[model samples]
Target: MGRKAKFNEGVIVRKGPGKKAKKTERSNFSKKLDSQHQKHRARKRLQKIKERQDKQKLLSEKKKKLDRIQRKELSKKQTEEESEVESEEDESEEIKILPSKGYSDDNKLWLKPKQKWIVQNENINDDESDDNGEGDSDTEDDHDDVNNEVEDEEEESDDDIEMENGKEELDDEEDSNLKVENLNDLSDDDSDDQDEFDSENEKSDKDVDDLLPIEKQNIKLKKKQAKDQKLADEEMQLNIANQEVFQFPIKESEEEIQSLQDVQQRIREVIAVLTDFKKLRDKTHSRSEYLDILKKDLCTYYSYNEYLMEKFMQLFPHSELLEFLEASEVQRPLTIRTNSLKTRRRDLAQALINRGVNLDPIGKWSKVGLVVYSSQVPMGATPEYLAGHYIIQGASSLLPVMALAPQENERILDMSAAPGGKASHIAAVMKNTGVLFANDINKDRIKAVVGNFHRLGVVNSVITCMDGRKYPDVLKGFDRALLDAPCTGTGVVAKDQSVKTSKDQQDIQRCYNLQRQLLLATIDCVNAKSATGGYIVYSTCSVLPEENEWVIDFALKKRNVKLVDTGLEFGTEGFTSYRQFRFHPTMKLTRRFYPHTHNMDGFFVAKLKKFSNLIPKSADHDEVTEENVENEKK
Candidate 1:
């Protein structure tokens, strides 16, 4: 038999595995019942949640519908009211009558018809017509006739009222005349009373005035006596103070006074030592000592870099260096160039002198140049300047165009032209006959060129806005070109003092590279040996050798161009050697102006001649080779 199971309190029991199996089945059945109950509860909860959501959605939609219906009703009511008001206004206009001539008389009291009664009657008629569509036209006509008769009667009544008012006015006039007569009599009596009162007041016032003078004299005497007594007391006190001071004079401490005197003497001596160059030189006594003295002097006296002093010493001798330092410290005079296109230099000069402006010729190089010594009026805003009779330009800036020497009927390019100072000068030199391509990179700056071109009456010029270095890609074969490349502006420090510290070595390198590119592009754009002797003028307002000679040196190696003489007689030759850098030997042909020597801002100008048969390198061959490689890959 299978294993038997014993029961604790029952009479019979099943034993072992079967009994345990039975118990497990019972437990599983109970668990399934519990699971079913839980599932039913969950389903009921979900249904309740869904019902609540549906109710909320229905409520919201109903509210929105109600709001829309209310808005429509309100709008309809407003429209109906507006229509009613419009109809009432129309009815009133139809029935309204103009005022009669009798009512218009000034003596008559006019009565205006009450518009409210007319409006109320019209409204009642409109309501009655709405209740019954058919209305009696004859009745309306009769009512209008009655109204007209009433108006006629009212006009007659107004006429009678005006007649009565006229009579009343006549009576009032008569009464006013009598009243005026009585008022005149009363006024005469009042005048007599006032005369007597005035006479009595005048007598009283005369007595008071006669006594016031004596009283005033007595007060004046008292004030004078008090002032004299006060002055005498002050004089006596001053005398006593003076006597006390004379008896016992103030004494300064001898040591402190002597120390102060010594301090003043030492200050005077130090000032003398600092000012006297001979004393300073004697103290130094040698080349190294003098070098140290110059470094300190440049720093303290000029507020300049010691490096600049060293470089200047290398360029100039000791005797000349002092003169250069002195020259750089002074202010430069204002210089202007007369526009020969509009007026002669002599005539402009005379006109300026008549207006109290002192003038002097700048140099023998430019005949139209004038240096303004003094002026009572603003030179720039003068009638002559506004009329474009002259261009305000630096004397140094005129050198490049003079070196270019563009002739009439020849095409020329002024690269980097802005504010058109030099470009306009070129046009003037060309006599406005040639096609001068005035180009600038900045769009805003180009507007200035256009304005100046128009002002100066330059008809042969065409303005183009483009980079100077990119001129080679778009333009070619110019008779002449002026590339006034941008630079560090160190040469114009006297005019712009901020330039002294605005740039550094890195800035010089950047300017040098840009000038090189622009110079190369300018050479490529201009013809080398045209019938009119094509040439390119490269210029900068920089004093640095890197931007001047070094740029030329680099271009000479890369291009088939030769540096030629700029034919500027006033400036010195360019430096072939600067520090460790040695430039091309032909760089000496270029011109460099120094402020100390030339009495102008330092400038550099190099004239270049391109070879006649020269050609630029091509990039087509590389492109073709790349295409072949791609075909092979395919």
Candidate 2:
């Protein structure tokens, strides 16, 4: 139907000689396939067999490891149980060592066997080697014997026993093969062990001497050790007690060293001004003969061979100043006291130069003068002073005398004048014609003032060492007076920086009291204007308000003295009081001349006049203006 299906029915059914050939080919092919399948099956069987053998080998190794672990665990448990028993025995032995009625001390003696065991344990680690060069093999044999005994025991499962037997047999075979070698090694090892045991016994016997009797020997040893330790500890404690805590010396840098050297140099220079080598040597030589002159002289004066004058001379032997160091010479410095009334500023300058005393006019107070340091001659010892050319006054100190404006023959009092500086100047203003009563509380200083008066050829002067407060009670009819009170000298710190460090509140309070006392003393000296119409100048070298303006206010409250403005055309106004003038050291023309500014001393001055009328003039009694005051609080 489908194109006759290619007419294959009879062809497909054809069997005959072709059928026999096909059957033979088919049988050959079947044989070939069977051979291939057999080869594959053979390979699978070989692989399975190899895997089984490997698994058996692995199981055998695992079983051996587990057996070894069980044996070790058993041995560890046995050792721990043995340790507990030994510890309990040791405790019992310790309890037995306690003091008994028969024993005088709590000590015990060890039995010989006990002693030997303790000593052996102390000195040696556990010994694993038996008497052997064959020790390892012997241990293996012992293990195998134990395994065989374990196998013989009826307690184990049948399987375990069989495994144990198998292990024992394996070990026995190994032992048999090594028996002859082991016997020889064992014999050698036993001989060595005998020698070792004898040697160990001898060592133990020798060591026992160090541990003879546990009771007495250990107690004495422990006591001795305790004493030694106590002594050592005591010595250590003593050392700690005696040791001084040390501080490192601060190392100064070059600049600091230089600064210290400079300070020392300045100190030496200042000290030199206070001593004369010639006078010292004269006093020494005149006092004694046959004495160690140099050493004794040093010991008597400085107690060290470092007196400023001597040190300077030693350093500068050939210096021109050496002449002044000679015993016969007298070295003195010049002093210039200004005369504002008579000598004009320019005329005074020329007059001083003509007199061969170098003079320089101080600023603002052209009336005040200074002797030039360049001129080596001593102006104090000059003939001009004898002839009343000048009074050796401080440059800043001349401000008050100028501010006071005393007339010719006007009676003036210098309340605190010592060595007669301003008093002599006041006398010069009066042309040595008016009476000037110069008073100082220090009697020792009166001689100095007298000497100054004599040198200056001053005539209208009287020097007294009475308290200034008693001046009104004694004799007081003066046109003017100066109360140069003592102060804390804070303003002078620039000239001497040490003052800056030295000042404190305590010092200021102390100075405050002193200033008040001095002011009171001065107030007592000034006469009411109706009586001599006198005035007073209050002054100090202090910058503190308590010693300056406050002191003035305190004086005014207690006395009839009226504050007077200096009317100085040059310098600035003073503190709060318009009448009083302030000269700050830092300013150009102030009464204070600080080292940083004018290289001069610090000073303060206030001028006042006693009102003659009962009721003071409103203009004269003007309150201080706010602009004149330093608004910042002190």
Q: Specify the highest-TM-score model's number.
A: 1
Q: Tens digits of per-residue lDDT for model 1 on 143-261?
A: 34333322233233333333333223223323432222233344544445445533533322223223333453674577689999999999999897774210111134223433434
Candidate 2 residue spans exceeding 4 A from truth: 1-335, 338-359, 368-373, 383-388, 493-503, 530-532, 577-599, 612-634
| Model 1 misplaced regions, further than 4 Å | 1-293, 305-315, 613-634
lDDT of candidates 1 onward, in order: 0.67, 0.51
lDDT string, candidate 2, 474-572, tens digits: 876567778777677554443444453355665666666566666765666666652444777777876555566666665566556667666455443
Cα deviation of 477 in candidate 2 (Å)?
3.5
In model 1, the number of clashes is: 3
TM-score of 2: 0.40
